[model samples]
Target: MIFSSLLFIFRFLPIALAIYYLAPAKLKNLALFLVSIFFYSWGEVRYFPIMLACIVGNYFIAIFLGKNQDKPTVRRWLLVLTLVFNLGMLFFFKYTDFFIININALFGTSIGLLRLTLPLGISFYTFQTMSYTLDVYRGEVEPERNIIDLGAYVVMFPQLIAGPIVLYKDVAAQLKVHKNRYTLSEIDAGIGLFVLGLAKKVLLANSIGALWDDIKVLGYANISTPLAWLGAIAFTLQIYFDFSGYSTMAIGLGKMLGFNFPLNFNLPYISRSITDFWRRWHMTLSGWFREYLYIPLGGNRRGMKRQVLNLFIVWCLTGFWHGANWNFLLWGFYYFVLLTVEKLWLHKPLAKGKIWPHIYALFFIVVGWAIFAVDTGMGDLAMFFSKLFIPQSGISAGYFVRNYGLSLLLGIVCSTPYPGRFYHKLCRQKKEVLRIAFLAVLLLVSIAYLVDSTYNPFIYFRF
Candidate 1:
């Protein structure tokens, strides 16, 4: 269920919050767990058991690792078993089709594709649970004895679907926490954040998505140069607002329940370079790969060649993790090539830490999305790029400019953090009155958008 949905906004959340805060301190975890289970199960009842299995299995694996700290071999074995178990599920559910298609293409034989139903949030929840055992194996954190706490950690509804990818160690303290009371201030802040996120999704992301989806729907054959460019730019905004808006809503909900979830996105489009952009975009995932993957792979400690190889590996995984498509792999490698080149050469030269670098990075990323969004060939992406600069024969170059005037304006505005920042500054300038006015208008407008939207799903929920 989307956070913006009428049922979620008006019914589920309000009832959950009331039950959550009203429960006795000892029962708070149970309340959160039940609500979270219900929240996820509301959409995918079949996946609830899958989620439960993950939670239970990972907890035991972590506990085993914790108990066998002295035996590196035992700990390593436990980690590997759990890793395989988790990744095996993810592979079967998410990547099985992609693998099947590739094998069939290569050998001209149908390997009998497993048309399995992918559980919702399998990508996200699996990663979160895996991190738990991984951290325990790494000696970064001790295991939690309370299964309820661990369950809450895994199923925390806010960031559960797409995440800031909170580490167990980071939130272990909070899960172990209990509060006698939740204050009005906390509720107000949570409500405010949730509403703001709803606005970001409904008003901005959804609006941009309509235009971007239209361009992609046109495919390569019919699109004009300017239209392709507009489509590419529109997609960039769509992803950022969609992902960041969800993160904001999650964070806001966490606040209302007095849980301090980590922040995810940070004005990523404003970043000056590919490296800077990675640091800003989907920060939790970046941090996760860096800490869990890069660091373990010896990071920069092994020097340049290994660093480059490591970068390639991380990007490939990042891409593949997003989807089971070849485009995702290519898109990831594209960034790897760009990032490596930037680190080795461009960091000191053209587009170095300047506005041009941001433009350059965004240029690469948007084109990457062109590759990502289209379920076609590289030639198709190439055609779109060709059209982007050299106009097609029939359609005028101004097709995008003419057709999506308002959406274009909204895309440009929502692309950066400036709107949120400017609003904050304005609020600080006038404090109460302006803040209330802003909130009221945004709340009503977001509600209107939600009411009208048939396209309301938190994009990351299927992650």
Candidate 2:
């Protein structure tokens, strides 16, 4: 039930919104909770029990932590137990096969893969639940007594599948006051933003993604250096638009529902440094690690060496968090090296440079995406890198560029802040009619694209 699908857009959303709006103020949380469970169950009904267990388990665990705040030893043990429970579920479903394969390879044992179906949004909800428990233990937030409210927060369909990764504290107040938070202006803004995001996903990302898809089918060995680089750039754009589009849609939906989800992407492509890129890209995830993992591991407070170790741990886990692939590990290590170098030395020089820094950051970022995208194992990954770095002639990028040049241009331009700035300028000039017309056209065009195309894919759903 992707947001871009006609079924979801036309059926589920309208009906759900109608039900939600018609519900009494006191029953709003219950309405939201039930509707959200239905949404999750629509795609993965088999996993509803797992999600229910998580909601129930974490809710009680948090309550226990909140109650045992005065006892440090008991609270610490409960927090550890909570971590084990959340991480255990994630590990079993997401990484069990990876570990099995690795162990089989290392020990020459034919361990059959469990091949468990990962519950959708398990990664995201796990973090959200953990954050709630951790905050409760820290005395930062009172435990949510209302299980229905907590369940609604956990299974909120908008950001549930692939998130900006909303934390409990961020929406705790909004959940309480949702009755009063509804406004026509906010709904209008949400519609506009959702349409814009829909255009980005259906039009720009999917069209540009076709180029990379073609290159992949052509095989790494058959592609010219230019073609390889072009594919890398295309993938870079596709992933950004795909994930950012989903996040934008999720945020917009949050707005419509009277919740203010945090910003996820912030023109990350324009970042001149790896550090800057991380700050902009999947910002909530970065913040999650920074707050829960990095700071706890002493952060920069101890010394450079300790901080480096902390970063290594965070990046390794961050990489693994994306998937069980070795390429993801390399991708994380790749950024770890880049960020460590920048933190230790390159930051000053990057800031000092002008155009070259942007080029340098972009160059590495594109290469990093290649690593992230190629999951066919190390041989293909190495071959792809060879095609990218070593000049070889086979198929030129000319044909692909001719086919996708407009989409590429649009993607590049939209990746920056200029388009958003221009739109805002029009709004500031009181061009309400123009704004409304533009949004209407965008929505109609996006719906047309959705109706016509079968290539709609949400990249982050795998995570």
Candidate 3:
């Protein structure tokens, strides 16, 4: 279930946390593992077996890799086999339909679409499991000998559905020592963070998302250039807060459970360059590609030409990884081009500027969101871009600005680091009571919104 839902907030989380706290230290992992399975299966009971198989399959594969460290041939084959299994499951579940459609289009064949409902969190947990296998083979981490510990890591509900994509090595110690590390301070911090993230999702992202949805419900032809731009900008805010808000909740949940997941977002909207944006946005994914895909392909250590090619490959895969849509590919390639230009020429001059660099960065970022919003064909994309640039269209800018102006303003302001800085400054003044009250108010308001509304949807669930 989504973190924002009343069912999750009122019932599931409370019950789960109660059980977890009541369990003895030695049984905590078992409690978490069982609850996590319940969490995953709550929405899709049929996929429980699939998720369990992944945990069991990868655990044994990692064990084999760890055991055969001295046997290069065996280790290599095992690694390849494990990777194939992980990636094979991912592709079959996530991309089989896309492949069928593409083949039908190109070969003039009428292949039926599989239309399989993708197993939730398959993309994220598959990556997690694969990383474990790779780390074991490389001697970066000892294989997790206990299947329950491994299963808990893979299926932990906090970051399971959408993630910062926790790596095995990063959390191996935490898992081993998790039972011994419960602290009141950590739980307090987690409560504050969880409330703050809840407010971001319920108060900010969901409210702003309506503006985009309203415009979208009005077809592309019904929006003027300014309106189109405003809608695109609204979506940009919606996605940032939605994904980042969920990440915040995940990290907070990790804290509550005495584990630490890495931070996923870093105020990416404040970035002044595409290169800077990648470093800040969905940072774990970028780091994943850099470590597993980019660096292995020789990174920038190869000459500029090979580096460029490597980037292109990574971006294409990155886009394809997001979905089966062509627009996602375009979105990926769009960044590739921007990043390539930045590397080749733009970085120096952009770094030299102050205000203009931010303007430049935001201009491309807004346009990029427009590309991301459209999921269909290039023709619709062309039409949307035409309306965005041409002034020949529908609604007046005044109406949109009048209606959504405050939300837009709040979105712009909150996208920066100032709000967080202000909060920390308040905390340093020995304002513990004030901080507690603020979080309490935020939690109450968020709960009210959750009870009243059904529009809550975490955007990253599709991935």
Candidate 4:
């Protein structure tokens, strides 16, 4: 169930929190694990076994890694095997159909598509488990001996589906060492964080997303230049707030449980270049690739040529990680190209200017999202790109502006750090009553919106 859903907010979370707080000290992990399973199963009961099997499988794999840690060759072989198992599961569930369709078209072999449904959070949990095993092999962190704690870490519902991709080492200490888990102040802060995130999703992302939907319904070929740009910018805003909002909620929920997940997003829109953008956006994923994939693949240490090839590989894999689609691959390579350009030449120029840097960043960012949005065919993407440049004779631009002008303005404003700064400014004045009242209103408004509408999908769920 999505965090924005009424049932999850009113029923599952409340019950889970209550049981967790009421449980004995040692039983807290058990409590969380049980509730997390129930929460995950609420979405798809059939895949529940797959998730459990993963937990069990990885738990043992980690033990074996720990046992053979002193032998470098044995540890390397074990790490390879564990990654293969984890990544193999991820590929089979997520990419089997895409591969099947390509094979059928390429060689005229009628390979029937398995059309397998991807298990919820398969990519996330697999990465988490793989990281754990690798860390154990590398002696970066102690292996978790208790399967219960390991399961709890993997199945933690808050960030399970869409994550900042929490690493085992990050939370291992909290799980095994920390005794006093919760504080009233931390819970209060969590509530405030969650309320703000709810407002971002229900009030901002969902509302702004409607404009993009309207453009899609009208079809890209029919849209004017301004309308095409408007749709692209609207989606760019929608996805940021949607995914970042979910991450904020996840982090807030982590705080409520006295755990801290790494922050997933900074003000990425404010970035001046694509290189700066990756540094700020979905930070955990980039860090994961940097440490586990890029660094291991020779990184920049192997000279410029190898570094460039390494980046190409990482970007291709990163794109395919998002979905089983060619556009995603294009989107990945698109950034690879931009980042390569920046590294070789444009970095200094883009870093020097203020207004122009922002303009440059925003132009490419919007264009990238346009590539990300279209799904059916390259023709549709080409049509959208054409509309973005050529001014077709249409009056939809004025109509969209009239309809979503305020939302667009709010989106642009909130994309910066101004609202957060304003909130912090208020906090400095000792305005406890004002802060609580504001959060209460936000919660009420979000609840009202949730009750009234059903267009509340978090964009990262597909990944």
Best by lDDT: 2
> For candidate 1, what is the lDDT?
0.82
Residue lDDT tens for model 4, 210-310? 99999888988788888898899999999999988999899989989989899999999999999999999999999999999999999999899999999
lDDT of 3 by residue, 231-333 (tens): 8999999999999999999998888899888999999998999899999999999999999899989999989999999999999999889988899999999
Expressed as tens digits, the lDDT of each residue in 244-337 for candidate 2 is 9999999999988889999999999999998999999999999999999999999999999999999999999999999989999999999999
Residue pairs with clashing backbones, model 2: none
Cα lDDT, all candidates? 0.82, 0.91, 0.89, 0.89
Better structure of 1 and 2 per TM-score:
2
When sorted by lDDT, best at the front, the candidate numbers are 2, 3, 4, 1
* TM-score, every prediction: 0.95, 0.99, 0.98, 0.98
Give the runs in model 1 whose Cα sits over 4 Å from its true position: 180-182, 350-353, 376-379, 397-399, 426-430
Between prediction 1 and prediction 4, which has the larger TM-score? 4
Q: State in Å the error of residue 38, model 2.
A: 1.2
Q: For model 4, name the residue pairs that clash.
A: none
Candidate 1 lowest-lDDT run of ten: 391-400
lDDT of 3 at 216: 71
Model 3 bad stretches (over 4 Å) = none
